[model samples]
Target: MKMIDLTGTTGVIFGVANHRSLAWAIAEQLGQAGARLAFSYQGERLKENVAMLAAKLPGSIIFECDVTDDDAMARGFAEIGTAFGHLDYLVHSVAFARKEDLEGTFRDTSRDGYRLALEISAYSLLPMARLAAP
Candidate 1:
């Protein structure tokens, strides 16, 4: 079988929460194409699982990044730069929602619930892109 060469391509993927996650699925494909990958997860609880997935790819690194937090995003991308020196691609498969917001009427959703959902699901991408951009 012929494999695509992504030998010099570097990328950071955000929001790989589990093995079944979209990020993980894309990561598996990227690895098979010989891409250098860095994975950023939202919480420490997911660190082990993310690390395990990262181990499957050659020269992959796992770092903690809460997309809503300024410091964490900054630190994580800094570490990525130090590790890979540059970024060639980025993927955003991160999202979050309250059960009330998702399962029921939208009018009944709380303000904090809307904020939290937007923060994790949408606004988080801006900082990630900024930091990952060279």
Candidate 2:
């Protein structure tokens, strides 16, 4: 198949947890397409893994961006903008639910747990879109 020529395009990817992550696969495809990439990991624990994968792609960079924190997301997008000058796209492949919350029926999930799941899984995209917009 002819590779999509993404030369000169720039993008940020969120949720590359490890080499096996679907996000990592997407990043690899984007890299192969010639798009420059920046990866955002949720916490320090994930930083090393993301950095390692990003290093394999020329000109790729990684940043810490906990989606639960607005400040961190803002800073991360700012860093991406500064690094790439512009964004052509963004890939969001992150989602989370507490272990306990996942164990029981949906009705058994606590209010806080439900809120946390939605905040991380769904609501995060809104701020990310707004920040990445500019």
- The TM-score leader among the candidates is 2
Model 2: per-residue lDDT, tens digit, 3-104? 799999999999899999999999999999899999998778888999999999999999998899999998998898899999989999988999999996
Measured with C-alpha atoms, the lDDT of residue 80 in candidate 2 is: 89
lDDT of each: 0.87, 0.92
Error of 2 at 7 (Å): 0.7
Residue ranges of candidate 1 with Cα displaced over 4 Å: none
> Which digits, one per residue and each the tens of the lDDT, describe model 1 over residues 1-134?
43677778988998798899999998898888888999997677889999988998999998888887899889988888899898899889998887777877888888999999999889988887787777
Candidate 2: where is the Cα deviation over 4 Å? Answer: none
Q: What is the TM-score of each candidate against the true structure?
A: 0.90, 0.94
Candidate 2: minimum summed lDDT over ten consecutive residues — where? 1-10
Error of 2 at 103 (Å): 1.4
